[model samples]
Target: MDSNKNTAVISVIGKDRVGIIAGVATLLSQNDININDISQTILDGIFTMIMMVDLKDNVIENSDIVEKLNALGEELGVTITIQHTDLFDRMHRI
Candidate 1:
């Protein structure tokens, strides 16, 4: 792995439904983002997923990933977020 590669912590949350995984995975694949780790489950019809992805080879910037995910989330009736690893770690440290 390249040390310069950026990593993003991504989370998806909402009521369970079809196409969430396909939508997210397709977008990531299209952008050259690789999912390094992932966990997903549903409870009482609510869907939740957390993923760590390497964005070093991304075709777009980190901010654009956030925007695209947000838009996709809206279409899917879910909440999708992408945060850079540095910021994610700092935010969790408190």
Candidate 2:
């Protein structure tokens, strides 16, 4: 991962199912977003994931990604959200 690249946090939550990661990854790859780190787990029957992605090389606008992700989430029966790393940090800061 390139440390200097702009980054964003992507979160996915929904019922456990196949292809959640694959779907999200494929979309990101198509947009030139690079995954820097990922963590996922199943709590009971729910699936949750957090992905840190490098967006400096992305070819599309962030708003477009958000729209695409929202569509994908509907298709996959999951909720997907993205936020810039800085804003995410600030929102959660104590």
Full-model lDDT for every candidate? 0.84, 0.87
Among all candidates shown, the one with the greatest TM-score: 2
List clashing residue pairs in candidate 1: none
Query: What is residue 46's positional error in candidate 1, in angstroms?
Result: 1.6
TM-score of the candidate numbered 1?
0.81
Clash numbers, per candidate: 0, 0
TM-score of each candidate?
0.81, 0.85
lDDT of 1: 0.84
